[model samples]
Target: MNKKILISLATSAVLISSIYADTTSLGEITVTTATKTEKSIDGVTASVVVVTQEEIEKTGASTLDKILEKIPSINAQYARFPHPSSKSKASISLRGVGANGTLILIDGKRLSGETESPYEMTRITASMIERIEIVKGSMSTLYGSDAIGGVINIITKKIDKNETTIDIKYGSNGDGEAKNKNVNFITRAKVGTFKYKIYGNINDTTPYSISKSYSQVATNPSTGSAITTDAQHGVTGVSNVTYRDESTTKTIGTRFENDFSDNLKVGIDVNYFKENREGEYIGTAKYINSGTPILVKNTPVSSEDKNSRLDVSLDLEYFITEKLSLDTNIYRSYYKKRNYTNPINFTGPTNTKFSANVTIDGIESNLKYELNDLNFITSGIEYRKEKRESSAINPDPSSSEFITKVVKYKALFIQDEIVLNDTLNATIGARYDNISNADNKTTFQAGLVQKLGENTSLRANYAQGYRAPDIAELYVVSPSYKDGKRFGAEVIYGPKTTAYDLKPEESQTFELSLSNKYNDLSSQLTLFNTTVKDKIELVSYNDGTAAKYYTSENLDEVVIKGIEASFSYIFNDSFDLSLDATYLKTKDKSTGNELMYTPNISASIGANYQITKEFSSNLNFRYIGKQFTNSTNTTKANNYNLVDLGARYNINKHLQFYAGIDNIFDKKIEEELGTNVGRYFYTGIRVSF
Candidate 1:
């Protein structure tokens, strides 16, 4: 079916359901990420989405990516086998912007490691989270960099009474391949003035081969057409790659808080995570035949990847006076990764190794003052230092050497909130940042919210955002080699030269939204536009050899604009439904082409039905429109649909059971787009005390 038809059907369903719906308001929910202060959803001018603990449990998702992909205007991509050479990691992007444009936080603090790395999200399990707040649009006025797209803040749970919970789950594909197991536990207790929480989790998955369900498709040189074949050798598109890698992930964390009188409170948090993966693939090898080099296909290659992270933080809250208060956070994070590849019969080295280590330290303080009944002011200062040591570009294989880089930055920001009247509110903010080895930057933002009626409100916002060049883009001196598929050819990437004179990418964003809640129906519509300049892009040159050399360079401008709509209706006490859709258009002015991977249309519909007080079920459907995979727009990934169903049964307050199936129709897309691990079934049990 066409995208228009599907969208129309979804809209009709929402409208039809609203006619007979009867429910109560969701009540006031406060969010802190939008303004760095507690504000109700209706009061925040930005486009925001909040996933509560109840909603999180209903999804039956074990990882962060699964939960985020269902959100409107958010695009998520996953890799079956993550590898350093491939530079492929599971990622989530806001609007049509890339993953690097988004900022992720845990309890308002940035995660440790490469700012662009999405692996950090994978380490966060669903069991420990109490809620998630997603604020869309340019946020650089409050956050200095990497906030052009938006920000996601994860809030952990806090218990007032002593409690302990344990959960276990297992899942596998219908064909009995790619099995997975997960176990997690959380315990919390409260004393007279102190509170603590402890949690741990372990997850493992077994690898499987794609050949079981897919066949190799090679291009016919004579006719320029694609042909499916079963040949094991001399083929361009080998289907012998591992569909999923054998992997194991572990996590442990603890939180402690103390209240010393009504004026002061202190808290400490510590978290640790570790992951390991192993996989094998059939690739190519070079051999000498009759004094000529011959490329042989179907060569066996093995790889191993390992990653670990540690985080420690201290938080302080104090009230200097009744109208003034101060909040502070001090944090340190460490991350490391190591990868090894061994090709059985290759021409060069027998083994290749790559490793990276990152350390970050940061401190931030904020003070809020109520100048008068209608005016409020907030100001903050932040300082951060990051250091990275990596052998990613060390050209030598036998020598264990690495290149180290350090970055330090300081920032100051202030914001004012003004209430013009009972029906209108306004906010303005600005920030200035100074970096050690980069140009200084300053950003500004303004927003206004006006009530149209008792049940409707209108909001408008404007902001400026920027992103600084990372260490590898500015300081790498050596070359790194990787064999990959690009533009339908087996290509090799040589060294990526550094560009010391690269400037920061800058953007301007404008947004307008209308929201309304009437009876049992709630709806919202938003329009947004973003224009970016001095964009940093990797430009490649094909040397006479088979290698493509690259350099980071400032490119021309690009523009992205989109429309988003969402509706929810409660049919009765036992049934509720939601529908959302997004339409996007992006263009690179220099090339007059749409941005790669930016789909024009995407939508979702979800419904929940409570069969009884002890049993509940949910069904969800997702659709993604066709998208281009290359800058030239020659290759495309066709549209696909997904359906998921889950149910929960509560035997008592202390014990519960849940089961679910994902990709019920077994929809599959091109391998280049992402892995579609066919139909999967999972069941789990939870016990609480």
Candidate 2:
């Protein structure tokens, strides 16, 4: 291990742990460290999880998709466009490998990609999100190709010290909500070596309703009759659909940090987002009204959507000698999307998509040393580039249209973090990707962490991952006047060369963890085993007229075994309690069955109370077990439990008041096909200046 003697033994173990004291606490600051420290997430070897901002303000949950549907091993989906127009796709998926192998970032840059999930889709506005780190398994050796189902970054909102705020809401179906203010004003005088920081944020939301139909007509759980269809029709999921296919996120952001002398510091960040949306659906049939057959239905759907995004980030740190240090980063992103559709049983074709754009650029470098006191070392290098474009139009007249394909990607990586002592720690990383369509692969990872006292801790990890093939799954094309040649170029080409032998979907993971803390209490337990190879599925053929022609495959092997747990208790300091659980068992080792929406079990439980010093209250419960919505598993998605309530008041400290109630006891869940849906409450208030 000679990289200049592991940087002189990590600069003599950070000068013998900085000459004795400074336990490095800020909870072991390892978002790649900078002072603050607390580090032990089972001593890190990567398997991160940090959802702080006071746990999203103690889960008053106003969005971030209701705090990621209470974790349950993460799986989120939303829409603005995608699918057969699944009423505007705003998707996010984690465990089932959908959502583009899951990789979404902000604050750490990189965002924009969507042809129905390949993860670089952008439209950020979770009230300028303050925290969310979620790094679950397989990071493709530190992010490459959507990290193959991991990595979620999204940490905005910083103005440490001085602050300002405002939030408001209304709930129960007809629902309406708003987020309009957050201001920070701070100052400190000093000259010579200088110091400065500036922060900013402004966010808004007005469209919130993603389906809730009902204006009358029930009874039809399999022909009980009375069935009017479309679940009755219009604004009736029993309140709480919020805006029918949701949309309306406006955001403005700014950040600046500098300190010219203390080892040098620099930071600059910027962001912008705008979105608008619309949706509708209804159906029922029984022709021959003239002859007296009655029962006619048609409400089709009308749609409109727009999205814009821009982000820029640059950060640098240099300490040069004293032990040696250098860190650099630069990022760029730009995106645009649009959609318009009108269908009233329009029978194929009438859609419009004026433009879609995505661009990204990234750079990273890191080096640190502190050898001694057992051992120390750190290294890094990273690069990424991506581009995408699209255009479309189809107005029928028997149809024929065009505009497709322009995707690209490139990646490189390296990592190491070894400190073997005080109970052991080790980490290794590697990544190499070059994809325009295919060719090139290399991913690796190794981890270990152990410390069995003062509480408890133990960890292990091994990873080897790969994922590639998303340009609508190897270039998809379908435009017809029934083959008069308007479009029909679905190519997979490339066996001799032009890049495309496609096969690049591999995985191997094994994980085990157990962490414990006492005195106020804290707990964690994780177990994972993943094995995948060429696993990508989507097949359906029947393109005669009624349409339905899809293809994408590699499904040869699969296995996902999991168990995750989190527990917290702080019975003092105003009371607290928390619990999170997940159990998964997905298999399809060539048809051993069990693998659809992949939901073996899910759970959540939460509680918090503090009736004094500015009041506080919280309660939560969530569970979503059963799953399967296809793949010969034959449709099945039932298993529901939900309840939420929140309260917070602190009319001083610049004023504060909050309210919440979601789902509560209004369970009507049933996704896909029989949609009964649910979400019955919303309440809000917040102000600070």
Candidate 3:
């Protein structure tokens, strides 16, 4: 469909909805991520999106990534090609800010491990989440590093009555490739004054090769011709070149809360996750020897990766007076990963083993004071320490190993929310962070919301954000290699290094949004602009050798601007509709080129209908516009559309059955882009007690 047509249709829907708008209230929706304090959605000044549990169930999504991709301004990449030997991880870029710029939190606490990796997006099951709150634009004033893009806070369920649920699902592609099975169980109960919830999940998926859909070919460097036989260019056909690895994941967690007295309450949370992956690849390599190019057949390589994470946190809330309260949290998290690969005839390493361990400990306390009816103040102090250790073992004793790195930081922040009048509200906040290894930094944010009428409001915000370099980006010492680098032969480069004087990336963002809620119609339109300085990027350079190696560097500047619009309307009790779309433009100022993998347009349309009290069905359509695959904008991935159909049937109060088909059209994109995995069908049953 044409972009103009889509935009016109969306605009028409909003106008139509307003014409038929009634007086029914949509009810008050409260969110805490915007201000770190509970406030109605209309009162919050930030651009926020809330996904409720009912909405989650309607999608029939098992993983968090599957559900988040439908939201506007969020681009999610899952199970893509050209991955490392380790298991595939899902990542998201908010408004083209890059994956590493976003911060993810569970219950308002950061997770341990590499901040760049959004593994939780895939590991956390949808059944365990009560709701998810997404706040767009720079949020460094509330959260610390990695908030340059935005913040995603996942809130888990807290049951008020005894309940238990069991869910089982099975899925497979049209050709029976990539078979998957999942099982989940959750139980919540109360013992005297203590309430607790326990949950567990297990998922397994088989590997599938894309060789049937795409083939790999080698080119002779001297003749500049395609080579099909080993005798022609000493190259053999590749096996499993484009394949998805086999993986198994398991998770278990528990949450406990108690009110010891009327003035005090305490809570504890613990969670553990583990994943294992297996993969194999066979190919050939060519190299130069004695000033002559030589092609060689390489031995096949197999790899195994094991990863685990553990997290524990304690929370306390105390009431000191009628208008004063205190909240404190202490938490600890640990992540470990091990990777092993079989010996190979080519490349740099044989019988390689790599391992990494990351640990984080933190404590925070906040005091909330209701200064008066018009103004509220919140102040907090935080202390956090991070440690990382990584090592690699190869048959060659000369290989370099990664060194351990530790960083500690202390922070102080305060915010004030003032209700100037019944129709206007203002918020101002600032944070000062002192780091042990880097320069101290301070950030600020200001926002205002003004009611234009009884059903319309306008909001504007400005914020500063920054991201400090992590251990892997600043201290990594590992060998790097590239395929088909020199005359079609793999090049084994020396260990990659980073400069000790690397500076943090900083950004300034501005956003404005107009929102209206009238009767059964709700709509919002937002515009955002962000300018970043000293953007960290990996660049390749030749160190006077034939081989090319990569190092971390800071670019001069980058600019990203985007517009987002969303609308929803309830026609009646039996049917509803929703539409959302985003248009983005991003550029690297130094290179004068658009950023890679940032799409120009994306949109989704959804409809839900109820045939009966026990039967309901939904249809969703998603469209992703063309995107460039490289920074130079030489290669492009064409636009694609996906259609999903889902239905649910409730047999009784204790049993429910649901089924869904995703990617109904079975669209596929270029291999340089991500794989679409074609059409998939899944069914599941939920039992409650």
Candidate 4:
């Protein structure tokens, strides 16, 4: 079916569902990401999803990515285990945009470091989270960059009392075919006005393959006899590739804070995460005469990588007057990573290593003033500096290059909230940013909220977004050297351009939404459209020779239009049901074709039933629709559906046991754009005090 028809159907569904609801107020949860302050999500003029601790606990999902996949209009690559290549790493996409367009923060701080932001979600554990807030649409008026699609802010748990929690889980694929294990320990303590929180995690898993073929044998044309060659005879068969990769991970994190006074506070956060992956290269050396593929070398490869992040911040607030207050924030972060690859060939073994170090420091001050009973004002200024160093990058087997780069940014923003009367509210905000060696840009936003009744509200907003290129995209130097032969070295650095000035990614977004909250039911409907210009993309062209050179440039203009609907109903206090769905229509303006890697339809439905005071059950259904894999829309990804079932038994207040089967139907997992895990069963026990 065409996307237009699908869009119309989705719109009809949203309008149809909104007709029935009671007159009630919204929930009491306050979201800080929408306006950089504590404000109820119902009053905000943008689309946001808040996942509470209670909601997360009921899902029984081990990883953050697995649970986030249930949210409407959110897409991510789903893999049971981390893969060996960069492409296999987990990444989040909003609407139909790629990972680069969205920004991710941990505890209101940048967790992305020098790497791609979306992939960094792997380092966070859902067990340590208090809540997560996801805001959709352009937010450049508040945050400086990469707020085109939206932002995801993860708020970790804080220590208020003394407590310890331990959880253990074991899982297997399809009747104990492959085994996986996880263990986690979390603790929090309070001493006077000082508090501390810490967490530790360990994960290990075995590999699973979709294909059972271990080796390929050659056949004689005339005699029809099978020919087998061993490694000793200079020929080998490739094996151990496909489906999912295997890995082991260990993580440790801690946060320390002191409330010296009501007006001053300080905190520091430290985290160390490490993971190792094992796999065999399954490449064919040549196609033999009899059509059998032969491998000259078969080697098992192992990689170990480490990540560390440290944050120290101080906050001070003082009231100069009864209606005015000043807040100051100073923070600095140091992130480091190291990767080692061991290609252990049966014949020859060699190891490759690379490392990166990045440091960022920033400070901000905000002033809030209540002009009157009807108007409120907020303004802030920030300055940030970043430096990155890399040991070496080997684009080819024979070449390695070292790189170092530094950049600075300054930003100023101001926003006002106006209450004209009891039934109407409006907001206006703007920001200006200056970056080193790039264009200075200004972004703005305006929004309105109109109450339809005691239980319903309609919100409309228009926003402008901006994003500066990341360090890797702007200046990572990968010099390619030809084979060592002549007197001079032939060096090439690409995507590093000096020929033409590159424009930053810019976007304009408009959205209209309606939300209703009743005694037992809550529903939200949002319709949005976004247009992006100067989208940064990797491109290549022939440079007056037979060879092609690559560079990053501002290439295409894209338009993404979509609608999201969410519904939740409580059937008494013991049972509940929730469902959400998204329909997106993204097109490249230059070609009038759907953008690559974007799904047109995706949905999730979940139910929780309490059988008794001691036992409860939860079931979730997910459907991922078809998507185009290539930019030109030449290849299509298969659509898939998954069913997950779990149950929990409480053995008093201090002990509990829960188990679940992910992909219960043994459905074929999607290769890249959908679920990529097999049917797996897991059981776990938790102890807390």
Q: Indicate which candidate wins on lDDT.
A: 3
lDDT of 1 by residue, 378-410 (tens): 999999998888764443323447767788989
Model 4 per-residue lDDT tens digits across residues 440-476: 9999999999988777789999999988776655443
For every candidate structure, what is the RMSD over all alpha carbons to the true structure, in angstroms? Answer: 5.6, 23.9, 5.0, 6.8
Q: How far is candidate 1 from the true structure (C-alpha RMSD, Å)?
A: 5.6
What's the candidate order when arranged by decreasing TM-score? 3, 1, 4, 2
C-alpha lDDT (0 to 100) for residue 163 of candidate 4: 93
lDDT of 3 by residue, 589-665 (tens): 98988877778898999999998999999999998888886657888888888899999999999999999999888
Lowest-sum lDDT 10-residue window in model 2: 480-489
Off by over 4 Å in 3: 1-27, 77-83, 212-234, 281-300, 343-353, 392-402, 477-501, 542-545
Sort by lDDT, top down from the best: 3, 1, 4, 2
Q: For every model shown, what is its TM-score relative to the native structure?
A: 0.88, 0.31, 0.89, 0.85
Q: What is the lDDT for 670 in model 1? A: 74
The positional error of residue 599 in candidate 1, measured at the CA in angstroms, is: 1.5
Clashes of 4: 0
Q: Model 3 RMSD to the real structure?
A: 5.0
Return the clash pairs for model 4, or none: none
Each model's number of backbone clashes? 0, 50, 1, 0
